[model samples]
Target: MDAAEALTLLMSPQGRVDPYPTYERLREHGPVVQALPGLYVVTGYAEADELLRDPRLGVLDDALRDQVWPNWRESPAVSSIARSMLRTNPPDHSRMRRLAAGAFSPRRIAGMRDVVRAQAEELLDGMRDRAGDGAPVDVLADFAYPLPVGVICALLGVPATDRPLFRRWAGDLTGVLEPEITVEELAVADAGAAELRAYFAELVAARRRTPADDLTTALVQVHDTDGERLTGDELLANLVVLLVAGFETTTNLLGNGLVVLLRHPGAAAALRADPGLAPAYVEELLRYDSPVQLTTRTTTAPVRCGGLDLPAGSTALLLLGAANRDPRRFPDPQRFDPTRDQAHPLSFGAGPHYCLGAGLARLEAQLAFPLLLRRLPELALAGTPRHRTRLTLRGYQTLPVTLGTPAVADRGTPAGAHPGTP
Candidate 1:
């Protein structure tokens, strides 16, 4: 397929269903294909890997963002993302990244282990009740979505009752990240961003009066205690970004991982038998069906890559999903093998901008998969799963599953569940 034709398919609903074919078609044009006069797409593993860490290929900083969308500040969602480290570069990015990284310290994430287990158990209890009598339940909505939400909320010290508010707000706010968003989508994002800002502002105030051990409180302390380091706007925007980032991609990871496990019954069974294999299994899942697919970088200076020479100020669209499955990187790239060695996928991206929540996502999945397999002995795909019609983040919209209870003693008293759940 021609470059234009391949891009057209990639942007269409058909590509949303299976964009791998289109990625391959684009790859045929070479590692880097010029889509337009100044726009290029990189689909090769080596090229993408090299470019992701190249500082010369940078993101649209604040000045450029203002130029692209002059009235962006009018939309809370766009403005929030524009201000956060998500879009910043260089000296600014370095400081913001340092503070954010401190908040998600290794000790903090490790401490959440017990909390994650408890939350997973509670969610599983609810899932079991909903699937009583062998009734089918939508895993995507019932389990996958709520599990991450619960985990992230617990870390942020958000109360259980207020948890539901994030579901709608996160969806509305995150739509702006898509490659093609409609006018209506932007409006929803604006409203969501506004509400999030207000909510976090109040929460930040509450934390100031009485400090807590949560991530939000930690951020509030930093912002107020050291005004020169983090501004009020940066604090609010980071909070909003954290709440969304904490769970959005993870929801996809859990949903997609379950489907992969089910398809390979042996892998599922092996996991049920021995949960120790979770680390490797989770890595393969990230490689097999990545939660995120693509990202972009702009040229800061004239550079040559992937056998192409381009002028400065050009946009390079990095095809992460394609690079993950590139034959040069992984032998038999299409197959799902948990046993595969050194399977380093760009699913979470690379370089200084690597996903902040990647470690947490892996921890959640590693814990989740084992518990899921053991609890639902008769668990199986009960209906056809539908993929979300978005290419940036790939996952299911609804995953119907059956949870039948056999009289097997092994299914008794799963670790995460409370009393009388079995």
Candidate 2:
């Protein structure tokens, strides 16, 4: 198969559970391999990092306008949603990012330690109660999926009652980011986007009538003397961006992290014994099995990456998963090592478009994982987990698990689980 066709198969749903081998092959061929016509794939850590920061590489820049077929151009709904930082370049991207940064500031996240812990504990409590004598429980459904969504909802001032709809919208809409999408899937994503927008539109109206001390309210009212206020479309777009980024990414973080732990029982036991290691464990989880596996950038100007000349108007797909496992940058890269002293993983991305919700995401994962383990020390996979049918997102659709005996509260005592706690 040609390079492009190979990548197509690798990104197909049939290969969703294991795309690493294909990534390795591509990396071996060249860190910067041309995947298809007018597109380059960067699999090296150094190169991906540089391109991410390069001014010539952008999202939805003029380059797209030039190359895109008229009939295949982004729909109005898609364009509307893409106006956020994820799909825009600096200046406008920087401005929109800064507006939301304050709410996700490290200080704010630090202050939320108690809140994160409380929510995690509450969620775990419910999970433990429901898991009677060894019943097969879906960890993704019971734990990972709910934590980040709950946190984002609380932060966005989204009413608790309305979260179910947002959850469905996020699940369907975020699938568009996958590398290879079928026409039917694309249509579903488009419909989901429209529904999400309509839902948020009503939400915005409600919030405008009765302002709450939350990110949504802050975004609407935040202004500079120079008259910098998010426009109506911008507000809706950003809210959608925040919702997807804030929840879905971290949902995968938890799901993927659990799978990593399952693969390493010794490390799991170690973490269970020393809860203080939670932060490092969480960081390592991001590196070991990143939630986001790839990112797209189109060249606005000809540039050289990995000693290859990439022409203007070309697309560069950064293989973050492969980059994270590059042996040159990470020794024994395939090994899952929580004790490794890597500075930071590309899991949250880098440069101008680095994930804005990084702090909140880390906080939620750090708190949630330990609480989960502490609550059920004997947790093990109930059956083979089915990963989501998504290429961009490295996460599970269901994580069936069985819990061990539960311990006491606060004393590191494992929660008591009924016989066969699944």
Candidate 3:
């Protein structure tokens, strides 16, 4: 199939289940292929990896913004979004990333190691308390989703009591984040955005009145600085992006990782036997099937990829899912081998805009996986798992699992103690 044909499949509901084959076809055709007028998709590991680090490719483009948010062409709020880190280029992107990066540095995230593990255990404990001898538990609902949500809540200083509300908002935002959706879904997304903005506005007010020692508190302090901080709208938009992106991606990582282990009983047994294997398993899971399937970028100048000349101002959607599986980069691309010697895939992205929350994300996965498996050794799929209707973020929507009745260890140490202990 041609690039256009593959893109059509991507936009269709059927493609949501499995975009890998289509991505492979696109890669075979060429590294760069136009999806539509002014829209191109790149599926090669080398090309996508290079473009992510290129100085010429700009995220903030008037032409692309016109295409993406046509309704907000004349609105200042859209302009604020245009100025945010995810949408900007060069110095602005650098600045925004730097500010967010400080709070998410390896050192800072290291401090949260215990917090993440504790949150995971707490969430799993809740599920166990509810589950009978062989009761079915949704891994997504009972464990994956809530674990990361709690960690992010603690990270951003959001009240844990408001988790249910945040969960709803995250769902609505994820729907719109998908490249293809019906007009009604788009309207729902707009409404969801409005609701999020309103909620953040109030939350910011509360934080301003009484500052706490949390990331959100620090962000509000940034605003108080002499025009060096993100604006109110920028804060809300980025916060929404951070919360949604943070929870959605990690939740999928945990879910997809377990799915991989379950499918390969050998690796599952190995992990259960040796908790230390969890980190390596996490890396393998990212390589085998990443949560972030693709991302979009645009060229500021004409560039040749796969013998094709893509003109300036054209869209480029990098298929991270395909590139991670590229035969050139990864031998035996289709297999889920936890012992593969390849470097971890570009799941957290690369270059100037590489994910800021990567450390925290990895910590969450490393800690959550083994603890989960150890706690529920008899966990198994209860039904045919169904994935969320999202192409960009790939994960199960409902992963029904029959978990073993977990017996708690007497006087368990907190989750963070393991990493810190000598």
Candidate 4:
């Protein structure tokens, strides 16, 4: 397929289901191909990595959006995302990112390791309890989904009881991240954004009233030595961004990681044997099936990329999934080898706009995966797994699996022992 066709196919559901072949085609044509007028798609790893870090390229924020799509601000969902640090550039991006970094410190994220383990164990215990029913459990709902949501909620100081609310709102809001979204989806996302804003506003006020040892409280009170900090609106917008971003991508990572593990029995067995290998395993999983497939950036000045000269005001769609699998950067790129000694994947992105929650996401996955393998030793697919129909976010919507009875500690115990047997 040509560049245009390949780009079009990526927007189609079928292509979303499997975009690798199209990516290969795009890569064969060139590392960066002009997919359409004023639009380029980057398919190679080195090129994408360099372009992502290029200062001349930046998120299409309000000013750029106004020039490209006049009615962009009409959609609350779109506007919400546009205002986030993900879409801002330079001064605004720097300010907001610094504030967020202050609150999401490494020490804070490091402390969540134990919390991640406990939550993982708790979810697996629930899955184990249901194993006796001879019914398939959805790994997405029972484990992958809850683990990240729970961790993010705790980090944000949101009540665990309100997780269902966040899930509903986040589910609706993420539709805006797609390459193309329907009007109905836009309406749903808009409404969800309004509700989320109101909800977080109240929560922020509560945190201000009663300070707690949580990120929200810290964010609410954070300030630079020069008295620079997030404005009220910036605070609200970023809080929403943090809550949604904090879980959405990580949720996808957990689901996709589990699917990869289940499909690779040897790798899973290795992980089960040596839980310490989880950090490496998670890295491979991120490279193999990134939670986010594509991210867009706009050119602020004329630049040369992928052996082509592009003028200012151009848009580039960095096909991160394709780049991650690019053969030039990854030897045997398609192989799922945890032991592969390779540079970091562009999964969490690169440069100034790199994911603020990358460390937390990694910690969650590193801890969750090993715990999952230990808790669900005989976990195997019970039915065909289904992927979410999202071009930007790639992950399983439903991962049906049966947790076979856990082996007994006694060596003499017969195989296929009753699931409930001690």
Q: Which candidate is the best by TM-score?
A: 1
lDDT of 3: 0.76
lDDT score for residue 103 of model 1 = 52
The C-alpha RMSD of each candidate to the native structure, in angstroms, is: 3.5, 4.3, 2.8, 4.8
Which digits, one per residue and each the tens of the lDDT, describe model 4 over residues 1-422? 78898888878888898888788878878999998999999998888899889999998878877876799778778877877787789898998888768556788877666667767777877887776787898888888888888988887899988887877788888888887888898899899898888998899889878989887887788632233566666677788889999989998998899888999999999887766677788888999999999998888899898898878999899999999998888899889999998448999999898999999898888777766776678888887788878878888778899888764332211244332111
Clashing pairs in 4: none
In terms of lDDT, which candidate is stronger, 2 or 4?
4
Question: What's the best-to-worst order under lDDT?
Answer: 1, 4, 2, 3
Q: Which residue runs of candidate 4 sit more than 4 Å off their true CA positions? A: 222-228, 407-422
lDDT for each residue of candidate 3 in 9-98, tens digit (9 for 90 to 100): 877778878888788778777776777888878887888898888776767566667776676544333443454676777676776676
Q: Write the per-residue lDDT of candidate 2 for residues 61-105, one digit (tens) a residue.
A: 544644563433364335545666777777888888888888898
Model 2 weakest lDDT span, ten residues long:
413-422
lDDT tens digits by residue: candidate 1, 1-422: 79978988998999977899899999899989898778899998889989889889888887777777888878899989877888888777778778878656778777766667677777788888887777899987787888888877777778778887987888788878877788998999899999999998998989899989888898888888997688898888988888888888999999888998999999888777777778889888988888888888999898899899968989888888898888888899899998889688898899988888888888788778877887677778987899978888787878999888832433334554544321
Each model's lDDT: 0.83, 0.79, 0.76, 0.83
lDDT of 4 at 339: 93
Model 2 — TM-score against the truth?
Answer: 0.93
**lDDT over C-alpha atoms for residue 354 of model 3:** 87
